[model samples]
Target: MTDFSVLAQTAKAWPFELARALEKRVAEQVKAGERTAEAPVIFETGYGPSGLPHIGTFGEVVRTTMVRHAFEVLTAGKYATRLICVSDDMDGMRKVPDTVPNPKSLEQYLQMPLTVVPDPFGTHTSYGAHMNSRLCAFLDQFGFKYEFLSATDCYKSGRFDAMLRRAAEKYQAIMDVMLPTLGEERRATYSPFLPISPSTGRVLYVPMKHVDAAKGEVTFTDEDGRDVTLPVTGGAVKMQWKPDFGMRWAALGVDFEMFGKDHQANAPVYSKIARILGHRPPEQYVYELFLDEKGEKISKTKGNGISVEQWLAYAPDESLALYQFQKPRVAKKLHFDVIPKAVDEYLTFLEKFPKEEPAAQIENPVWHIHSGAPPAADVPVSFALLMNLVAVANPTDTSQLWGFIQRYAPGTTPATHPLLDELAGYAMRYYRDFVLPAKTYRAPTEHERGAMAELSARLKTFDDAPTSDNLQTLTFSVGTDHGFENLRDWFKALYEVLLGQSQGPRFGSFAALYGQSETAALIDEALARG
Candidate 1:
């Protein structure tokens, strides 16, 4: 077998930092015979099924998958890697989300397992299954490789029986780790097992009346005033948050798991519970919360922040993939405003990857984003530039973009330039939604008009084809000679008069991209209006 471990040790890639740390920790466990060397490295992501999947859910899985791919590269595919997406569908529904219609109906089903509650939309058998399918659909849209596991199925199939019994045996220790985090009243009645009410069919949070550790059973009184006894090991019970998290890690032998920073305080408690239950907790990754534009954490149930559909509407999947590929610890604002930049950034990285040395290419963000198989061709056009072109040219169809694209990068076709085609589609949508309504073109100042006229005259002097540099120099000279204080103000005037935006891509690149004749005609039209 190829020894990629040595290669992993020497690589300076950003992903290797996390991959090596995990590998080293696991390697120590192997050396001590705590784990077998051939054991598959499992990367797991948790999802809450109380509501539809949001952008944050997409982020967690995409980010975890990126790390999984990096780990695979580090192991040279010698060690097996599996990404498991586990949904906490068995958890009781605490509140009905606003996104669901007629939420009043949900009050009756409160405290019931999400898997058992009727899907408000009536699209599926239950709310949990619908939400889980939504999560799966989002991942499918990105063509991500993963295994979907449901908490409800795991319980019903008896896969969690052993862990349930272990929790009952270590009940007091689990309570000791969790109780201090709760209020005095909650601490007095808290039990790890939430037995399913025999009458109401709801998961009951009421205090456990009796526990038999040896029998793996818990007894509780139903709301109907009758005693209920059931084995906690079967489908009759589910553990609370901390204990459940720990139990899953131990039972599944997960190698890595990630959660939001909001769970940072709870991580140690879960780790302790895992250790007490005879397994060490998986390697933990705590990511900062996805905050709104106001800098508040975006709540999943509020249906706040950009939705997965919303981001995918204006941008491609790779753009969002790049957004999630950044450092997990750094908090990022998720909003529509972030899409264009992220899209351009992804394209920029794609454009640069082929030119870098093998060592640097391996470390490139695009490498990890594309799972070491980045696209070979570099489409020189940027999403922002394309958006501006759409604003200026007002293409009736996507084919119009080909004219401008081929001017700079010849022989580029929709067939050959798939990303640019997709980007053009995004640009049109973005221009219509964000750019068109806000457009307010200013009539150029007389001085600005004169400068533009000079630019028009200078462009006419170019006998040969105009280069971006030459066009840039001419545009710069017009501004400098016409008493503009700096090129910043000059470009500002150009964008305001021409594109009706305060900022844009390099004007020279834009001029060359739009073709000299069309650019000259644009200046003439602006000068006429002035």
Candidate 2:
């Protein structure tokens, strides 16, 4: 086995950097005698089941898993690790998600804990359970290994009882940490503890009339104006979001956690509250939010971003993983158009992995993505090439595409190259859905027409199979010989005329894959149409 500890110490990849930091943290904790075998290093990702899990959710868990894998490599299996996925199901439903069925039905349940609200789809016990199930299903589909923790279960089952009492004991201090951040009106009404109404079963946001820290209870007026005193433990009350953030960290002793940039401003409050509760806050990573095509932040309610399911329909999950792996701190546009490049880039990295030295391999995203044992890349053709093949061949099924694939890569079959066969299917679907509708064939200009005619005549003269290199050279010479100052213009003209798109795969490789005589015929057909 290759030893990655030396490489991991200096590897500049984001995961390795994070792993090293976490390793340092563990070392310090061990030195202080705070770490033990019973308490494993905990990596956490939070999910709000306000809506179905989106690509952003997938990105967080997958990225955290990458860091966890790196930490394992750095530690050389000396310490245990656990990945916990926490769902805040105890949160009150503020509004109905527009995407959910029966939106109006959910309005009556607003202000109630999500665990108490009726499932809009009628699939689970409550809306929160339904959404949580969807989240687990989504993650399971990708084969993620994690322990799912529900806030409702934690609070009701007495797991958080001690922390709840601790919060009650520190209510004034917690309030002091939060009150200044809110406006005067909100501050007046806000208490760290949000009591659940005994009569209505709603999570009440009313102010605490009195906090008895010794008794671990708070007195508050219910919505009906009835004064009531409730114990803070045993699901009788829950902390407001900001306080809850810190309390969860302290209660769980989470070693590391990551959240989106939206929560960055509140980090200090979380950390301070955690310290007040006598626990150090977890190391936090704030990643930039994903944007839509318009550069607007992707919102689950608005449904502007491409979803995990949507991306998988047009590309492999490996491509989606690659998308999540690259430049995570940078805001990226998540849309259908980004799929092809991610697919091809994933292939490029997979092909490069075996040839890379151990030090270089440690830096490769695939190494971290696959936990250092990435499967051999079996696909011989690029996704871009496959998409172009779909464009020109207009194959009705994978078999037709495979025919051309077999010709280009001799002896290759669907059984032998399953990934490539899968790519062929994805390419066909992508072409039909995205490419076909947008394609616009235009007539070639007079000069361009003559150049294509010369190219076509030359291609017809090739008696033997033309190599990609020789064909590329022939096309380049033909472009320059036709008085085109920029070779890109010649290629652009070809794309417009033949593929009915502005951009395409490398012409020589594409031509070699789709036959030379067939390409010449395609040119003649384009000219005839013009």
Candidate 3:
């Protein structure tokens, strides 16, 4: 029975820091009688459904959830909370995504609301519906507790009708906040509202001729040069993206939200517009964008970075969450190579959690990732070690790796250690996909060859039950005894000759798990091949 509130107060983890800020905001609002304690504190993450949801979208929701959980702990459940994942489905599609099928088919629908654009996949009624389905499925897979929202649905169902009317009344005041952020040309054509043309059915971005605040209608010239007057409510008109950002906040009474660093510059504009619309803007956390292997910003259209499916195929979702939790404000390279490290780091944190002090545990990421109660670290083997086992064993089935795993961690079975069993499967898939194709075995140098041969023979004399420390010491002696000046060359030689990779797991731990006799036979095979 740990006092989480005490721990949360001193916890330096980013989520706790954010939760404290939110707590303060809620307290002030309650004190001013602006909100009741029973009112749910809103946490929001916005998505653009022009393309399929990507890993960045996953990061935002997961990170926001972490803060939400922290807030729950800090407040001791005194204040209710809500997480809203909203998709900007009413936004017009500007261009076809490079990854989607039938790019030419979507060209005719340019500037139409995404909810109206035909889904090229032909699976859903519209492009926005198809994308929204994918986004919901993606979030649902992670078991996130949230309410899904559609911008189109919100506007059409009259949920945003009051906000739309408020925007109509304060149209000029909202424009004052946006006009300075744009160039002279953009400022001239830009109106807070984009009218949905009744004739073309496309969202008309043309400059407005007149706005009747009392009538909640706008007069805008359509593409055919005919002036049309449409009511602002009931989905007839939607605000531009910038104004929509602030208006959504004002409408939802969102207490907290987070977005990428790209939106940092416009945060003030959004806040100002929210103030003008008569609601306090949410506390915002702007995180750095994730980059691809070549250091370019990850784009959903480009499909350059590792995707959610790609990551889950090679690693557990926990590892992916751990990656999101760490250094969120700093840019990280999202690629296949980053998978192993993320997995191992997650394992390390889980292993440390139960043993850590309550204060220390609060700062640990696994606590926040699991909402304070992390499962026991049942996997005795590291992902890197399991990957090496797969590399060397080249097992066609998981049972083969399980055989080695059972030996290293005695009494462990696939049934007993399900996580380890899962890791074994993940490692096998990773080795087959990534490690096997790039494997290049280099013949050992003269000194290295003699050292390996000596080491192999010595391994035969040792008992099967020897400790990893004992085997590590034995390997060190063999390397030094063979006149190797740099010990790195010894391990490098072992990796190239034995593992077919330039770097690998600690040879001692790998051998202990992979069996000393089996490792000796592997060395003999490598030597014979050379």
Candidate 4:
């Protein structure tokens, strides 16, 4: 294995940091003799098909791969492990997907296990397999060693049978952890890989008790203790969630698994299940969810998401990597508007941290990007701020916007920021192609107009040297004059008056940070527009 324990990343992400922690813990396990030297370090990920994989989805795997690479360097071949990707395609259809045509007919069978759904693509052996295989393809491109296990595969291999028996054997303990997490009404079973897919109009489940995929049937005692064979495609994996974590550990020997914060009970529940299974639980890293531009959780299952595929169309894969590199541990909404600024922030960071490993350098210096010492690790620029700056710069005409772009983002000249060239491309594309054109918010109400007139009168009185506090006061006062809510509201009005658009970026900070003259001129333009 490489020297994973102490590997250095100039721009460290959560996974890199987590990798270090995981190594120390594994060493502790080995020293305590709890794990043999030869035991594999299993990195696992579970997937459900609500829609196309998003950047967050790839973030999990890429980060894990980084950790796995480090672990390999450390073990030097003494330890072997693989990232096991469990596609819970057999899970029930939670919602009708936009990607699929007319899933309404599939709705009646919505709660059925995934095994029953006919492959919409009609290519893979089953619908579940088809959904999972897409992910497998993406991972394959990344060249990570992964085992794509469907629920069907696990049951067919009798892997789940052992877990089911254990769940029955450890029934009380399962509920002890389960009830507290899922609530008193929910059932506690021990399967994580179960899924529900749709087939025909009827719902089918892969019975939780005993599923046999080989014969396409499940064995269960029909309450009367009579052994019955149910169609495998109808029912789905029956285990409750908490016990499923334990089953994963006991059956798969999983070493580490990360999840999003939505699964709040996962940690405690997994712990309880671990005790019941007589196996150590996997290391856990819980992450926050990604939101859309409006701050709603990005979900393709609900026909909402700025998907990874969509993101790739605009952002370079590595830029996307850099986006996830900062694990803020809080929910963030991402959208196309983010790109125009993200490009500059990333370029600035790379400029600041120019020293990086050979792997990071391009064959050509002109095109090369190296890590900033801290890689500007955080290029703290806000979209609102940049947009405001742009507003001040003369974007009224295409030529003026280009001129303004040249001044601040000099790379547009090719002599300065070659990266800016790309940013300009993306920015121009976004404005021209993506941003929906609409009328500005209704003309400021009379009270708002009066407040703006007041602010104009006040500012009209002084030509004082600008300061931060003064600028702050100006933004707020201007809003008051306009009868607007606050400085932000004033700025919005200013944008309409200048560019004939709603919502101009930050004005006061831009004026303070850059200068008063540029901001003043921008304001003049806005007053003209209104």
Against the true structure, candidate 4 has what lDDT? Answer: 0.57
Residue ranges of candidate 1 with Cα displaced over 4 Å: 1-7, 12-14, 101-106
Name the top lDDT candidate.
Answer: 3
- The global C-alpha lDDT for each of the candidates, from Candidate 1 onward, is 0.85, 0.90, 0.92, 0.57
Tens-digit lDDT track for model 4 on 1-530? 32323333331444446656767777888999988777788898877754555566687776566556555544445577888887665455666665665666656656555666666667876556666777778877655577877755675567766666565566556545555544433434433323322223233222346655445445544434455555423223345445665676777878888778887555867766776877777778777887887789876556565666766666555565555555537787777766645554555555544454433432111121222113233223333343444434424433444464544333455444444444444444455455425434345555555655555555555487665568767767666654555556666665665445676445555556445555555444444555
Compute each candidate's TM-score over C-alphas: 0.95, 0.98, 0.97, 0.63
Is 1 or 3 the stronger prediction by lDDT? Answer: 3
Relative to the unseen true structure, what is the C-alpha lDDT of residue 30 in candidate 3, on a scale of 0 to 100?
A: 97
- For model 2, residues 225-249, the per-residue Cα lDDT tens digits are 8999999988999989988988888
- What is the C-alpha local distance difference test score of candidate 1? 0.85
By TM-score, who's the top model here? Answer: 2
Stretches of model 4 off by over 4 angstroms after superposition: 1-13, 69-79, 94-98, 102-109, 140-145, 180-238, 293-296, 301-305, 356-424, 434-530
- Candidate 2 wrongly placed segments (more than 4 Å): 99-101
* Selected candidate, larger TM-score, 2 vs 4: 2
* Ranked candidates (TM-score, high to low): 2, 3, 1, 4
